[model samples]
Target: MGGNLQAEPGGIASFSISVRNTGNTVAQHKLTCASGHGWPVELGPSQSSTIDFEPLDILEFLPMQVRLRIPPVTNGSPPAGEVDMITCTVTSSNDPTFSHSEYANVTVSELKVFSTELFDLQGNPVGPEASALPITVETGETVNVSMSITNIGNIEIPLSVKLQSANTDWGMYLVYDGVIEYDRVTFNLLPGHSTTVQVTAIIPLSTFDGSQNAFSLTTRLDEVGTNQFITNGTNFLVGKLLGLSLESSGEKVQATVGAWSQYSLWLNNTGNGALNLNWSTAEPPPGWQFGIDSAPKSIDKLVSSEVSFGVIAPNLAAVGDIEQSIRVRVIGTYYNDSVEVFIDLELTVVPTLHFGLELAPETSVHDLPRETQGQIVVIINNLGNSPGGGNLSAIIVDGEGVEDPEWSLQYEHSFDELQPGEEISVIISVTPTADAGSGLRTVEITILGQADEGVIVTTSEVLSLGVTAESSTTAFDLSSIVSTEVFFSIVVLIPIILFVVVRRMRSSAKIYDDEGESLVAPGVHTSQENISERRAAALMEDVEKEDDVISGDISQFEIQAALVQSIGDLPPPGPAPLPTGLPPAGLPPVVLPPAVMPPAAAFSSSPATTAQDITVNIDDNAAQGGVIGSEQSSSEPMPEAGQQNVAIAGMPPVPPTGLPPGWSLEQWRHYGAEWLQRHSGK
Candidate 1:
């Protein structure tokens, strides 16, 4: 068996193990050891050792050894008997195997830490219970408070303090009194570093307080973790009261024109506040005017208490030194008063005039006929600022500047003083010879000195004296005359010649027949009736034919005859007899039925019709067939039979009244020519 050891009850146990190798071939051997108590055990190779066992927990112990291969020892001792049975092995080359095994024990402890510090401005330490300061103030007082904090801990501490007031009615309060909101800064503090903060508080008179008011301040540290601190200040007592007053300076007094006199007043603030005021004025005298100036007047805001503005007039007897009074009242919070002021003024009366003049009957005669009487009117006027009264006289002068004895007529009247704007009148009549030529005459008026000497004497400008001749035949003067013999001679001779020539032409063309019956050319008789119808055709064919030529010759003869006679003698002598017989040779016959013939023609044929027949038969066929007379044939075409019939059809039927047998062609031609000339011209 292998080496074994046992311990007796209540006794210690020891064991030894040995091994050797002496071969030249360098042999090796191993040794092992174990404990029955379960305590850690060790083994050795090629060495002898003894082991002792201690009972770990009151249990039996034994030692055992086993053999195992081992390398030779280098000269050092092996591990002790307390071996590490539960070994921590590392496979990495970076770790070493345990030569001996042991374990270490560890213990942990926690300590309290702080990040920020607290202190007062005077370097006084501020405890966690200290928060803010309290102070007392008056109505207008201001307060300032300053504070500082330090990093009391091993590490830097960040801190902030908030200040508040218990009473909001206090005018104003501040922390860091002079520091603006935007200028307050947050800072990082190093260990042992301290920062100072200022806070201010204010109380106003409006603050109502009999007791102290309290406010709180909090200081926080290391805002991240649960490290914080808080503090509060004691109550501050505040007490104050305010008072104010207002006054007014009366307005500047002024006046102007109105329906009647008027005045105005203004209440100006002259003290620290606004003011209300009352005002009034005195009545002015009659006819005197006054009014208030529209704009309000002001006074220095620091001086006068109240003022009055208005216009006034004193008693009439005091006009020399008239005075106006203005009343004013000051209505202010703490003051009330009234005052009257006098304004000096003077009354000035302006003079005026309204005067005019009126003349009695307003009319006068300048010049009259030799045996007629002429009259003159003189009106005196007091048209001035004063009355006028005086004696008046009148005188007349001829155009030659000689005073007429008859014009020496004088009219004097006693008159009362004419009031301003009054009038007076005076009259004077005179007789003068009507032989006065057409020229201006003068009427002098004089007023003897009575009311106003300067305006007394006066005279009118020249007056016209119209003189007319008498109605006697001797005064009618003829400017031109001619011998009655010459006048009558012309009057009788010219008419007779015209009459004789006209009668001769007519008698030469008078119709006479075998039976003495007159036959007027229908063409000549109806010419007037046919004028309008014939004019258009005639103008187209024979504008310059013999009928027109004869008309032109006749007009020339008339002009020559007019030159021989005066403009007064050109009307025809009398109405010509209507021709009743035929027209001269080469003219168309005019038929006369018994019903159209006169009673005289009923007994005998008219010479005009008989002659017209003879002339018509000679040229009727030729004329009816478009044969104009040899003289006009070259320039005019004869009318066709149809056109001639149309022309005849347009003629007016003859009236029942007919001409006598004595009528002639010349008369018919004259009447026809006159009618044709008038119609053509039209």
Candidate 2:
């Protein structure tokens, strides 16, 4: 027989047995199975389910093996001390009903389940992020801690929990209720089940407001190993600590040159603790004279204060437009906590120019007959420190009748090159057209000026002028001549009528007393031949007299005015010359023919040609007063303005025009230098 053994639930336990006929006689034996076995019995010798009537000779021994199977357990595995029964029987084949029986006990072994988790009194889970353990609590306050213990082993087990800490200074105790104070808590559990326990902790009035590590230790009832599975460390933040913040009034300021300015600076503390800041100002211009007024180095929490700074600019601190900046720096206790701010300042300066116009004698009015010419002089000046440049233009702004294009205005002039304190005279000329009506005219002379790079300033003035019409064939008044004829006829006819009426009434009106009546018919002509000779004597004496100088009301106009107009047309229609101012009758009229252009010759660089060979001879006779002859009618058209030819050989400039000419090269150079000037100006 084998001693009892141990096995888990639903497991097999095997043992060996010996059977023999110990009484010294032939015997038959049977082997069979019993309850508490894992599988059916299998005998080795016959490979049968059971042993039946096997012969056993005297003094012979037979060995057999037997097996018992353990039944399954449902709710949990059996405890180590738990046991079950297994029985076996051997019966005699002969002499039936004679048998022997045997019984054995089997025990099972298992491990205990042990696990734990934590929560709050409200049944909410607690972990490191919740900061539930080692919490900061007021003195004499008790807090309930909820924890779950789960059985994870295959058998029932009980757990012992205790508060444990490596630091001796932490003063707290684990409690089960109001009275059950202990170092640990105990609970029992079954396999695959759990139980929750409320663990209380108390803080003494002497506990410090700092950090401490708290944890729990658990041990199984049947195992010697321990687990430190519950652990956490927390920080208790409370009471007062140092903190700080900073602020300033503004960031920018504007100022002017040669002046002083002040800024009201403010600082504020936004934290719950006092702050101490060290502040300094940056260097300014030498005479800018920067100063900070009574700045405080310390400030209380939630408080604000003001600081002022000023920049006293010297008279010559800045002369041009510019910008500058000043900086203020504040240092705190820590390197990263410092605050530095900047204050930006600006300064400026500018220059000016004045322009004016003076029409000499203000208004120079001229009285000129129609077809006569005159001039007015004007001056423009600049009186400021700055030099100026601009353009000048003349406008015939107003008048009564139509302005004659032939002689209305000569030219517009410019004084753009005037310097400071400098004056320039522009000559304006007028040639009253031959048929112009009588009236007073006003003309506006405008000077549009600019100074210092396109700054616009303008000024203008009005000039008064007048014109008187001349009596001639083109503008003659026939009514005045008719009135003269009527006056003469009435004077003569009235005397004749009175004389005839008186002669009829008295019958004797005129009785001539012929007493020595000399016949001299108002100094009458002597003999016919003598009167003819006398007329010839008078004409000779008149032609011999010298020509007198007579300047018109508008003098020296046509010759002085630099007016360039197309001269292809003849003089306007007018009357014949007066007998008193006429030239001598015997001279032949001198006429100059137009020049023919040589092949490919331009006036600028043309070489000598056939036209240059044609010579002209002016008469030695002095120029006498000549009337504008009736416009000589011809079928041939006059030359165009650009095609007119000048400088023919041996031709003196008509009427000795302009400054008298000199034969020297220097004189010619000066004269011709301005020849192209008129063509190029605006």
Candidate 3:
């Protein structure tokens, strides 16, 4: 009989058996085998060989062995059983009637096992027991650990793979066949087959440097009523990677000239450790100023910081925007590694223009004469931050609140291209007419400046001027004493006063005799010494006649001087010296009889009279008779009957032939007597 046999699945099961010839007679037989489980059965070592048995031999026993192979589990394989039988048959090759058979029992057994290992991405082994090895990684970095799983058992099984991390900050994942699974996966594995599953670990940026993390990968049966089988794990350490990020609050900045501008900046530390940051600038525009609030600051890992800076433009800066750059550096305090970043900045400037006027204290108020000129000096200033130019002018007004036509105003300064805080001096000239009286006056000066964008700015100032007189001292002014009309009338009245005084003194004079008896004649003037009483009446009539010669050329003083010279030459009138007393007193005593008067018949009939014609002979005693005449001398010549000759001494000569045409003959004969008459009248 075959002994009972047992075998594992997918392995060999063997048994030994003997077969005798049951048929009588020496017949040839074939030896064959059959299995209950439908397993492959071998009759001998050679599958095609047959065993011969002696036909009915007396007590002969032939030994034969059968081999059975356990079929691997498959979709078409029969169900496994606790026990199975294998039968061996001996049959006659020549006679089919004589055959014999024998059987053996077989049993099936299943075995399951698996192994695991860890490798790097390059397929190199990590360590003897991959769980004890440590891996280095930076923050925010992803690393893969290759895990190899092999099934060493005699059966195919489904498995569940899982990845786990020791630290919660690390992210774990499992990848198979290019598909990622979060920390766990399920798949099937056949016996004696190998596969690779990727275990990935991700480090967070917030993780600190030098931090440690442990990663575990485990595999187990996926079937029901099975426990986990294999486990693999690894360790990771956080490394230092220095990083920096710099950002500005705004990209553009606006500013004015000579003014300050401000902006904000933010610095972020992206490294796994702390860092020291330093900030600086490149070359800027000339005369520009910079101000920073915080510099060279320290920042922790994953932390951000904010700072502010200021910039001031120059006073003479241009009116447009400019570009500049700034740099920030991260000094690695952990690993001595550095990083740098540069940022571009923009600047803008604006223009402003303002003006002012400054007046000197002395020029603000002044005293001026009407004829003299006055001047005022002032300072013009630019008070803003731009370069500009404009116009300048002046206006004047008097105390009566009206523009004074007599007052003139002028400014000799022209303003152009003035810089900020620049100053210029201006002179204002003031002039007044002669008729501008003493009063107060005002002068207003104005300055205009052109600002940016065609805007105008103006400033003005006013000054006072006091008018005064030309002379300073008090004195008599002859030039102003009288007007021209009054002076000419005083010169014309001085000549008429002298002529009336001389005429009254000549009319009160008289002629006297030696005994105080006035020389007298009957009805005749006594002042005539050279003419008889008979010619005095004719001289008085001639002196009264109107003549042209005496009115025009002759003066009264010349006529009076001639009369005085002619009268002084005559002797004063007196009785002739008594003829010798007793003129023929003896002869008169002898015969004193009255002498007889000559009768009127004895005179001839002629009107002409002379000294000789009127003479009568009188004896020495003729005074007793009332007759007075002298004896005519014999040597005296006689005059014609109608003519007479008269002569006078010390008189103006006349025409010798006759009287003047306007004069009568009677007046010519007595021309010498007119001087005597006028002298006696005065």
Assess every candidate by TM-score: 0.19, 0.22, 0.26
Ranking by TM-score: 3, 2, 1
Candidate 2: regions farther than 4 A off:
2-14, 19-32, 36-83, 89-101, 107-159, 166-182, 186-195, 199-214, 220-682
41-84, model 1: which lDDT tens digit per residue?
33322233223222222232233342222211111111112111
User: Model 3, 329-402: lDDT tens per residue?
Assistant: 33445546777765666666655565667775656334466556776777777755676776677777654456
- Tell me, what's the RMSD of every candidate? 44.4, 43.6, 48.1
Candidates 1 and 2 compared by TM-score, better number? 2
Model 2 accuracy (lDDT, Cα): 0.47
Q: Give the poorly placed runs of model 1, Cα more than 4 Å off.
A: 1-357, 362-369, 377-379, 385-409, 412-424, 438-682
After superposing candidate 3, which stretches have Cα over 4 Å from the reference? 1-8, 23-64, 71-119, 123-140, 146-158, 162-169, 175-197, 204-214, 222-228, 233-682
Candidate 3, TM-score vs. the true structure?
Answer: 0.26
Clashing pairs in 3: 25-55
**On residues 1-682, what C-alpha lDDT tens digit does candidate 2 reach at each position?**
5475776655666676677787568988887756453434344454444676468898676878765555444455444456666566778777577778777677765645455666643344556534553333334445566566777555767666665554444454555434463566666678767776555555555655453445454434644574434442233222222333334444444332223356677665533345567777777766556666777777775576776765554332333444666666554443344433444444332222344555667434455666666666676666433456656665442243433343566546555655556777777766667644343455555665566763223233233444333443447454322343565887789999999898898876544353212321222212332233334433453344467455666523332211111111233348422212122122211222212211221223322222222111211120222211112222222222223232211111111122122222122212222222221232
